[model samples]
Target chain A: MSSSFDPSKYPELKNLLCSIDKIPDVSDIRPETVTEKVIECNSNCPDPRLKTLLDNLTIHLHDFIRENNVTTEEWMATVHYLTDVGKKCTGSRQEFVLLSDIFGIAALVNSINNPSVNGSTVATLLGPFYTGEFHDIEEGGTIAPAEGPGEPLLVTGRILNTSGEPIPNAAIETWEADAEGLYDVQYSTYSEPDHRGRFRSNDKGEYSFRCIVPIAYAIPDDGPVGDLLIKLGRHPYRPAHLHMKIEAPPVYETLVTALYPRGDLFSKSDAVFGVKTPLIVDFELIESDEEAKAKGFKKGPFRRLDYDFTLATKEESAQAKEKLRKSMAKKA
Target chain B: MSSSFDPSKYPELKNLLCSIDKIPDVSDIRPETVTEKVIECNSNCPDPRLKTLLDNLTIHLHDFIRENNVTTEEWMATVHYLTDVGKKCTGSRQEFVLLSDIFGIAALVNSINNPSVNGSTVATLLGPFYTGEFHDIEEGGTIAPAEGPGEPLLVTGRILNTSGEPIPNAAIETWEADAEGLYDVQYSTYSEPDHRGRFRSNDKGEYSFRCIVPIAYAIPDDGPVGDLLIKLGRHPYRPAHLHMKIEAPPVYETLVTALYPRGDLFSKSDAVFGVKTPLIVDFELIESDEEAKAKGFKKGPFRRLDYDFTLATKEESAQAKEKLRKSMAKKA
Candidate 1:
């Protein structure tokens, strides 16, 4: 069939796209046959991983379309919606990642790739707000502006391995919304990074930073994903969360997670499905003026949050993921 | 839960975007529980059909992800590819539809919604190449430009119903590629439609027009869908086919279809998976001078294609689709 294709007629396509030699016969396609035809068509993918992914994608997508009886108009609407979401993405925003977050796809993918093991921190969705522009801060230093708005907060945590030993000098990236439910990037005249910082744990595996208490915030809802949330009877609010990415180089798998302060309105139903129970911690209110001064707060009645992050070595994480994969394979 | 979400703090979100009243607890998510949690979270969607669609979509998508062990990198790649496709769509092009076409999703959706009934001609994908810019021509008039490039051809067809009755004055829109395997819009100098026209069937339900013989063409390959085809070891050429959209108004279902001339190298493996055996027709080579002049061509060596389109009435099509749905439901 490859030799039969007469590319002599069109010089532009002559050697650029070699005509395929083996094509599944898609001539007699019916509803029952279309899925197989599409799958077999992709059987020649050079990467086995990609081939398997496409095959499974074809099977599930076709089954969903057929089983749900998705009408043409509905499908077209969906396509249009997706296009709008993509168009909404720019240097400062990523609507595709937002869509995945709300769909729990990003979380599921994160969970699958970084399954829970050895009591390590559970990974969550790395949302659209993370930027590559965080400035470094020292221990007990503030991530928020020097005179930022909000109740002052002190967060202290140590990075530890599964064996309860300190894993010192781990790199940590932390970010949070201000008390007004806005990130630094959400501001129009944002020049310098605020409320987000990169720092490393001390030799004692201890990490501490001062910032405004995290607050429940609405995700940007002007795009198609926001429109979808409305239709799905969902709200675009995430509970008060401190985004954290912790990495102990060489051995431990990096942990991407969020610390949700307890008793937030939206914690149980975070818009991005980012909250896990163990990651929720307490915020103790301290009214002692001396204690506030000691913690670098300007005044009393500041909040104190103490939590510890556990790390799983790379091998532990891989073995955990492999076990889950084997169990899923058995079901399949 | 409804009372628990204290929106008192954020006045901006005060009256707008009411926090969801019933949200499933997503606190302890796992692969085994995430899909259901997400689905349950959406249980409050007011539109039942949308809910059903979302539910099926969630089920199949999660299953595909888990079963394939789709890694974060792979899923991210898919998401980014879809984003690129959406970004590529403009006023003159639709990359999402093209993506759906090559994946056979568009064809399968078309097949499902317009299931064949009692000798009715099957419907096919209304591909991305279709445009709303064709000029209207009279019966027996030529659709191709006076000096267009291609072998001369006459297309004569009648729109009929399953009972063999003429569907009079049906609106017909027909389009085809030029000899160079390019649509009129594919050209940089596209000021007017050359090989496409909108016309109506005659009182006798016959539609005839002069056009160039369609040629197999490569779909636009500079986009993500094209990249995917290469990765899947597939070509980008669609078989030579004359696209047609026929509608007889209030009684018959609109028929979106194309006729693939027999013996095209890409027919059995149409890149968009739009081929159906029943739509493959014979293009007779007529070399007689008299016949060519009678058909309004300037000389001999022209082609003649004669085919009849049998459409299903709206009711018939609906019944066929319902029957299929019921059967599928039984299986489910």
Candidate 2:
């Protein structure tokens, strides 16, 4: 049978045999058999959710190749693009998160995990700059200290529980770039404390601060994330806003909200796409003369914004936390 | 107002004010208002699809952050892992595809795109080892030309339309590694012409090939794909099989099929989860001393496999191509 068997009859078989011949003692592996390797590796994924995810992913990915007849080159290009996205991350930023944000998966997951509460403010994506601890401050204090530029403004807001009761001692940590739209951390010329402030609300659930109104600004654009934005034809500007995280008892629910100044062109079109109608408020202009004197200011023409936040019920807030924990565990 | 605005009232405000005094104006292109700047630059996304996506992602991602209060360090690790996955890709391989495959997006897309035809062979994911262009040979010729190892076998298969009508003069390209489980492209030790071959069907839609029986083997390790397998605690071996592509007249649909060696353990549990019952076949061992002599072989045992491929109807095939083209155009 060996003598009669014609190797030329099966070209694939011939190639396999030839390739195998070059390596001593080891046999040639067929292309048709590679599927098992892929399946086995995917099936044992430690996280059940991830295992299921990988399993499904493998099937579609394989089918994509078969259906589209994808070539080796196209596949390689995708790899290179992803690699650059990873290389772009810095200490304060993450490009992968940006990728996820653009892909809609992150949004989908968010929607699935975070259902709206009756009265609590809806949470949103924490932009890359969230460094956990913010300094503690007293009520009616100025969060912005640098005397650089822009109209001086007195911003006041109250934090309330779901039942409409005020949370007098709520901690509101606020951070914003200076009038030129630069964070203290981003500038070498600025000290560690520049442009970021942590303040606590008064007994009446009211907190006020004095600072030059911050200017709308763009995220850092010199990295790969910027390159991707260029490729996608997107500008990087975010509307003028203050970053505030108000945390009280778990019953009140923590609120991570961005207050966008009304009338910014891009307010309706935030680059990271994080604008809610409820979050937009007018930074009412105050002519410096009379109002400034009432507040004991010697100057003219400033701005003032008064906003109030209501939280969710304690049980509802706890449920949100539970849901979040499950999702994170699944992800891990 | 200046006298009433107490910077010391807000401790958090004091931190920001005291942390740094000078914020740089790097670009000189500052917006007039902070809210305007945030809306214009921080989240100014344009693509409607991407805009919606980012908005939702931010909400959910933020919720996750607030729910677990994810620390900066944990988030940094995720960033690093993603970067590593990106760095793993090379010219011939894609770690992202593997990542997507494991994540299930690949399989989902495949199922969404490739609906199966009734009675025709179901399509499965194309495992990674595809290279372009195969050498063409006449019908009834052997693809395997070298004297390598494995039980001598004759594989005869027919290509037919969905109506069970045979398609004449169909070009069928066949290739597989030898018993050792290595392809010519992977090994430099073997000559280029060694194990690979292509053959066209005869007028009767019949093709035969002579070659050694293929053995199941694992995919290549020593790469990111391998590292992933090790991390997931998976074996990389695949079941034995042959790869064949049957393409006839334009009216007939082209079919890419893999014939799995029956009874292989990995067949039912293909690593990539690509196994389908219809694609499996048995290679029956026969005692044929006399038959071997007729074929000029001094052998007592020989192997034979007889299989047939049924394609979708001409019109159906054309419709499939049109659908595929439209989908591809949409993606492009």
Candidate 3:
């Protein structure tokens, strides 16, 4: 035991331990010879987490190369495949995000970071195509353009403090797909602006909006991200829902929530895994033509939803913002 | 201790210690919220190694976000950027592989798995663009079809077993850039179908090929991978070299190696970190007009290199192949 522990023999022992003793002469080796080359090349990674990840990756990658005895031609094919994925990105869509989403990394990160909440909204993947900055509107004002397609929806929601007391004023930024299930950002044919708006609640802590009930649609699939999904046998559809961010005074929490249409097939299996139980609520189908007429909507029928949000206290708000800022800086 | 552990009095503690308790309302909790999230998220990671990595990554990611307090627009920009990287991949070249290279993932993986083999050749990144299926050529034949730009070179090498015995009939595959420092695949102008070729050693374990000396060149830019490199402040160049792979009988190991030309500055800092000390060899500039004339080449000068490679024993060869196979299967 003592002999084995001798540090003076480390060089030789390490050779044996790593199984590099009697190193092969420079010729007559397999195509997998590059495996060691790769491992040696990446040895300098400094971050411990990255170090471990890379190390494990190397072992697996090398093992992969050797196991298949991968030919030089096959390796080259992989390179070409990856190059196409890079060429497919555009302003409106990202293939890589779809790649990550399909690979489960996006879901994994969201799941790891967002713990469950009881009697409150659950967080989900924010997705890759959410364009920020919305036109602010007054409470109860109609935000969706008149020409946009959708059954008028009267969306009313309250911003409440953690103690269940109403917060007098809160800003709620909302966006969603049109009746045809397409966001304005996804279609160039639509007007420069449609189907998205921001509203501030009144002193009564209530905000309302009028827009058509959005449809459920599939994520884009004509790109490399789509190709990968097909290769992996997965669909790219997301459940129907309205995205919102509710913010009040520093004492109240800012809620990033999505209210899904009840009983959508994709509600249980969101592509990015963003759905939470609390965020699932009923979209009541009202048959009262009188009610639709009172709201200045078409006389056929309408859907209505009322969502109440509870915010965290002031100190928590500051901390959350600070944490988010730090993470963003690091990424930059 | 009993008081601190009370379920009714300290709901957060109770929730954390046992899964039966109600989900803790982490929102609006102040600085502790971030810390709690980190701990909670890390606790769910199943892999012990990954768990530790996630813990550190969360801390850093969170810190960066908080420091920058990045707007949703900026976050969306990042998402789009990554998406483009995914879209850029084709069937051959992978932008993500290049991304990983520039971000150090490639090098990190290389080093962690390649323990030092004192006398054995070191490996490097195979890169995102190495296509296989080289043309087959007879021993003492040429890989170059046309003059192909560079001065003609006579490369001769030997394949030997680990015990120093010559291994006859070893297969060798070779490829490299021309005088312009571009592979045929990189340019549509080059119509040389057999620029790359595979050969087998003679009974004396000797092999020779006629080809132009390859020059150093920069990796491709003008894409998302390029943008990332610019952001990270890195150059994209590799030194002059010839890529070679050798395989023989089961008695010895198989080898994939690159023979770098002596006196290239970038050899020391190969962008892909593929340089190996043992693999570096001198290509003599033959000034003998008589020698050049005898070889049917331009009379003033040419280059020649002689290299010999030794392989490990059979058991080691099997182990390496097994490892490679496992890794390759995982990707498939």
Q: Order the numbered candidates by DockQ, best leading.
A: 1, 3, 2
lDDT at B249 for candidate 3? Answer: 58
For B284-318, candidate 2 gives per-residue lDDT tens digits of: 87787987555434565767888888777667755
The positional error of residue A51 in candidate 2, measured at the CA in angstroms, is 7.9
Model no. 1, DockQ: 0.50
Give per-residue CA lDDT, model 1, range A1-332, as digits (tens): 11224456444444434544445677767888898999887766778888888888888888888888889999999888877887898767778888888888888888889887988888887777888678899899999876567878899989999998998899999998776787788888889887899999899999999987788877887889888887887778888888999988799999888988888888788888888888888888899999988878777888899889999999999899999999988877
Q: Which candidate's TM-score is highest?
A: 1
> Weakest 10 consecutive residues, lDDT, candidate 1 chain A?
A1-10
**Model 2 agreement with the true structure over A1-332: per-residue lDDT tens digits:** 11222335333235433443231111111222333445544443556644544444444444444444333344455546676775565555567776654433233333333344666765554666666645555555565653446667778778877667888888787877776667766665644565567877888888876766766676665666655564444545566777778788655656776677766645543446555567777778788588776654456687888888877766786686576567656754
* Deviation in Å, model 1, residue A99 alpha carbon: 1.6
Q: Give the per-residue lDDT digits (tens) of candidate 1, residues B132-241.
A: 77889988788887656777889997899999988888999998877777777878778887788999998888999999778887898788888888777777888888
- Give TM-scores for every candidate, taking all chains together and pairing residue i with residue i: 0.93, 0.55, 0.65
Candidate 3 chain B lDDT trough over 10 residues, lowest sum = B1-10
- Model 3, residue B296: distance off in Å is 3.3
User: Distance from true position, residue B285, model 1, in Å?
Assistant: 2.6
Collision count for each candidate, in order: 0, 107, 91
Better of 1 and 2 by DockQ: 1
